[model samples]
Target: MVDYGQAVDRQADEINPATVDQRARRLLRADEPAAANAPDTHLLQALSLVLTEGASDLHISGGAPPSIRVDGALRPIAGWDRWSPEKVADALGSILTPAQRVEFDKELELDFAYTINGTRFRVNFYQQRNTVGGAFRLIPNEIKSLPELGIPASVARFAHLPRGLVLVTGPTGSGKSTTLAALVDLVNRTRADHIVTVEDPIEFIHDAKKSMISQREVGQDTHSFASALKHVLRQDPDVILIGELRDLETISVALTAAETGHLVFSTLHTQDTAQTIDRIIDVFPPHQQAQVRAQLAATLRGVLCQTLVRKIGGGRVVATEILVTTAAIANLVREGKTHQIASALQSGRTQGMHTMDQHLAELVDAGLITRQAAEEKAMDVEVLKQLVRRIDPTDTSVGDLSNGEIDFNDSFSPGRR
Candidate 1:
């Protein structure tokens, strides 16, 4: 068998570093291995290095030193020599197919997943400051369930619905995709249906259990998410997952798909349930906002806002706020009452709805999280602290009101934060 590593080195050496960016190519050639002797880490080794280092991401720039992201922060590992520009080109040629390379070359940016053994990686390649650098996020072998993640039960319950849209929202590295996987897995085990997912680069690989799954990558199986959704309706799919509602076109297509009877799942980099909805509506122009909101109000099943908080044990856990679109909630959305949804979540506890602040206060009272940390991450710090009821050293029984009084806070706390 032709060794993949040797072949890569030969190919990289063929590419003229002078033609490409110089600094990166120079770094690549520094550790140039002979065609006869190449050092290639097995995909398994790559996965191991990431987990052992507690890295959120691994960077294998074409000609730069490999780096890792720890606790949502990027830090280059010490002592690892930088790869020369030619070496990176060689590695790139080794791992990526021609079509993938062409796509990368055109846009100089890509997001996809890589696999070795049982682990999966979320990969993103892009041109940065003139040099080529990429990030690979390791997807752990164990797919933590919603309960295990301490995400609200209401989110997992979304799996029970036949058709609607469920969104997982938060900043980057906040575990939105992980939560999405947990929900989809729940459906995979319980329901017998076809679930189709379109991602930039596929992440989790779910087996065909009770549900049949078809995963399509952006540049591999199809051109883009919009194209995938465009034809998904005819596939007789019961569940469709759009990796993200990133642009206006994709958002429009997703909403339309959801409206037609498919249970759509997606993610967004937003802070709360209301903001998540607003994000969708605002992505469109003024002329399209009303139509998008109306469609969202009708097809939207739920919204889960999540965050990864550092636990007392020195690891991360997701805390989430779940907003199920009840009749009142839907009415509020249809009527443009986004601000009132938080109040509805608080009062609709029996229906499995919950505001983030309520969950944060509960976490604090249960000793799962510190009160001070909760206040810092809380969207409305003043409101959440009031809900947490930090005894104002002044009064003992009922407690003295802080600035806003001991009434309630209005934000969602996805985790300990």
Candidate 2:
């Protein structure tokens, strides 16, 4: 019933970056209901646009038409109607359960998953200056394989490991869930193991193949992540996929699971391997820090930090920093010298360990992403510049290493663990 194309064309004119930000701020301040109530099919219409446009995310906020993010850029639908607080609430009632409304009212923020016409979405509902807003991420019906996602074969090696902790971390929207699901799917196809997963709200639904999967939603199937993790060992699970290691208690339990010979997969909001290690250790009390570090050192199997960037032509490319733990790296963790982990990664190339900069540079070399874009997301600007120069001989923006532009001894020191 909606003329989707006409609506998009009409609304596209009003979607300049400045106007988007201005309207967002204005809506945040006013936070009042308007004259019209949104029609019952408002939410469905927006979702329909997402599928038709192949967008990854949809953002609904007051004082603006529903906007979709495609290939990392937000674009407002052309003919969509702007939303008001009361209208937003009315539209939300169609998808939210009565109990969910109560929870949303109590906490002011809620997360859950919903299905629309066979496509699933990971939904987040929250308040913005007293107005209801929602962020919806489209979850594809079919889980993509590692090769399909452009992940290196080296990453698949971790999926085959029988024990220890393997982390896939990055900022939100970095495709962590996708990668985790792919790994779990790999195990499900090749091994006759029991896989148990604990998620806040299970995103991907896995079918039994070579393995049997038991997915426990944090609030629904279990009281909380900590509670489920506490009893998971008794579940006789061979491979455990924890949605996140959010707190000290959960982290401790995950570490324990890995130490006891369970191959545990988890995610963290970290940018690199060193930072991931630091975050876990910093979560514990000072007195327990040393012991936690040693435990992590002994159990950490690998870390893959990923980021999604706009590709040269279209879609998006994944850049990853992989850390496959070795004896030397384990000793470094035990010795409380995490800052030196970057150098270890540089020299551990044979072992598949590399920094974020290395991954970004590789993308630049392969022409999947532009050097400027890669450099912008790069961790070490100097190193990225050198890499880009090496790949592109004509690039003279940064002097060569022979011209005193870089000091390898200072940057890549082989300090003892």
Worst 10-residue lDDT window for candidate 1 reads 402-411
**What TM-score does candidate 1 get on C-alpha atoms?**
0.79
TM-score of each: 0.79, 0.85
State in Å the error of residue 68, model 2.
0.7
For each candidate, C-alpha RMSD in Å?
10.2, 10.0
Which clashing pairs does model 2 show? Answer: 7-78, 7-79, 8-78, 8-79, 11-78
Scanning candidate 2 in windows of ten residues, the lowest lDDT window is: 407-416
